[model samples]
Target: MPLLEAHGLIKSFGGLRATDTVDLAVEPGTVHALIGPNGAGKSTLVNLLSGRILPDAGRIVLQGQDISKAPAYRRVQMGIAYTFQITSVFPNMTIEANVELAAMARHKARDAMAQAVDHALETVGLSDRRQQLAGDLAYGHQRLLEIALGIVQKPSLLILDEPTQGLGDAEVQWFVDLLKSLRSETTLLLIEHNMDVVMAVADTITVLQFGRVLASGDPESIQSNAAVQSAYLGG
Candidate 1:
């Protein structure tokens, strides 16, 4: 079975349906990209998956278990990690401290927290800057720190929302490489506006339009899909 599955997911806000019966499957150790226009319900779907918001209907199953009614912390304990589009680090804390907090939350043991912090810094090649204050780092570093916190426990599934949003060309490339490396170890569900990066990294691509699935296929097919081109990759 796929590591993550969303079947007939539906979420509505009063009269507006942000997510309308969306179904998706993500395999283990693969890069899956979800792409669409500005109001295409990407973030809304992610919120539903991470338990920030409950779906109005449908089931989300992770590893043969139903997580549709699970709380956010319970979802985390079930090995789902989510990072927001905006950077979310403890501004006043050191980068190491920020990671330590996440480690503690995930692991409970002091030794595990230290190991998690060390591994997190090492994974992002930020070991040298662990002592720096989170707010003092550059925007890219701040974003990396946020990722570190989310993955310190090595969750089976990682969800990243627009991870390269405000980055420059070089930083964008760095994130692409970082994500590529991560795919070998953990399943990644990426919501990104950067089509180039998405095409380069994703094994499968799913397109959304008006909160519904427009198309889903391997990277090659998605690139050639006429409807997808017209809806998202404007000619």
Candidate 2:
């Protein structure tokens, strides 16, 4: 069974249906990309999966347990972590402090928390900058720090929303490399606009349009799909 599954998810904001019976399955140890044009409900789906917003109707099953009505904090404790499109780091805090805070939230033992913080910083290549204020680092480094916060707890599933949004070509490449290294360690659900990055990294791709799923398949299949081409790739 897939590690996470969304069954017939439906969320409406008044007359606008932000999610229309969306179904998604995320397999363990794979990268699943959710891609579409703006207003296609990708963000809404992410929110639903992270429990930031409760689904109007449907069920979310993680590890065979229904979590549709779970709160955001509960979801995190259930091994789900999310990194926002916008960097969500404490700018005034030192890099190590930011990671330490995330570690503290996940681990009660002081030694375990310290070890987690150290691993997170080293994994994100920020160990050298541990003592620097987050605001003082380059934008790319700050973004990595945000990712560190998400991964410090070793979540079973990691949801990244537009992780490369503000990155330049070099930084995007770096982020891609980092993501590739993480695939074996955690399941990834990525909501991304950069088609190149998505195509490069995603094992499966799901396309959405007008709050509904248009197509879902492997990268090659999704690339060749006529509906996906017209709806998202502007073919």
Candidate 3:
């Protein structure tokens, strides 16, 4: 069975239907990229999947259990980790503390939590700055810290929204490498605007347009899809 599945999800915002009867499945141990133009309801769809918002109709199943109505924190505890499009680290907290909080949410033993925090920080290349205040970090590092927070949860599915939004080329490359490394350990659901990164790591690509799935396929097929090319890929 798919690790995560959303069947006929529908979310409307007054006059606009943000998402319309969308069906999506994410397999285990693979990177699934969600891409589209800015107002394509990508954010709304993600919000629903993460349980930050409720879908007007439809159900979300993860590992055979229904989670459509679960709260965001509940989803996090149920192996869903999310890193936002914008950094949301606690400025007053130390970097290690930020990650520790995530680990604590899953009820890890003290020792285990420390180990998870350490590993997550190390994985995100933030080990050396573990004691630094989060607000003191550069924007790129802040983004990395956000990623560390998500990884500390050790989720079955990690959703990253615009992970490389504001970074230099070098930082973007680092993120690419990190994404590749992460794929081996956990399934990734990425909403990224960077086509290069999307093409590089995504095992499956799904394109949305006006709240509907326009195309979904392997990278080569998505690249060649006439609808996808004209819609968001700038044909």
Candidate 4:
């Protein structure tokens, strides 16, 4: 069975449907990229999967168990961790403190959790600024902190939404490399706009247009898909 599966997912706001009968499957140890134009409901779908928004109709199965009605915290406990497009950290607390809190939440221990925090900071290359307040870090570092929090719990599936949104070229490349290195440890569901990054790292690409899946295939096939080119690649 797939590590994660979404079957006939639907979400509607009054009369308009944001997600229209979307079906997706993600296997373990692969990076699955969800790409689309603006207003294509990529974020909405992410929200639904993460339990931030319940779908109107669908079956969300994780590790062969139905999680369609699970709450956000419950989903996290079940190994579904989602990092938002916007950075989310404790502005008043140091990076170490923020990460330590996440680690504590995961393990319910103190000293060992502190060590886990250190490990996560080091993994994200934020150990040097461990004492710096989260808000004082550079934007790229803040983005890294968001990812660090997501993985601090060591979830089976990690979902990232536009993790490189505002970074410059070098920073974006760094983030891409960071993501590439994670495939061995966890399955990643990424929603991103940069075609270059997607082409470089995504094992499978699923295109969303107007809240519906337009095309899905391996990276090379998606790159050469005429429909994907017109809908999102823009010639």
Q: Pick the candidate with the highest lDDT.
A: 3
Query: Candidate 2 at residue 141, lDDT?
Result: 92
TM-score of 4: 0.97
Over 32-85, each residue of candidate 2 has an lDDT whose tens digit, in order, gives: 999999999999999999998999999999999999999988888889999887
Which of candidates 3 and 4 reaches a greater lDDT?
A: 3
Instruction: Give all candidates' CA lDDT scores.
Output: 0.90, 0.92, 0.92, 0.90
Candidate 3 to truth, TM: 0.98
**What digit string (tens of lDDT, one per residue) describes model 3 on residues 1-235?**
9999999999999989899899999999999999999999898998999998999999999999999989999999999998888677999999988998878877558888888898899999999999999999999899999899899988999999999997999999999999999997799999999999999999999999999999888999999999998998888
lDDT string for model 1 (1-235, tens) is 9999999999998898999999999988889999999989999999999999999999999999999999988988889999988777889999888888777657877887788789889888799998989889999888888789888967899999999999899999988889988887689999989989998899999999999999999999998999999988996
- TM-score for each prediction? 0.98, 0.98, 0.98, 0.97
Compared with the true structure, model 2 gives a TM-score of: 0.98
Compute the lDDT of residue 135 as modeled in candidate 4: 86
Model 2 lDDT, residue 228, Cα = 88
Name the candidate, 1 or 3, with the larger TM-score value.
3
**Clash number for every model?**
0, 0, 0, 0
**What value does the lDDT take at residue 203 in candidate 3?**
98
Q: How many pairs of residues collide in model 2?
A: 0
Error of 3 at 11 (Å): 0.5
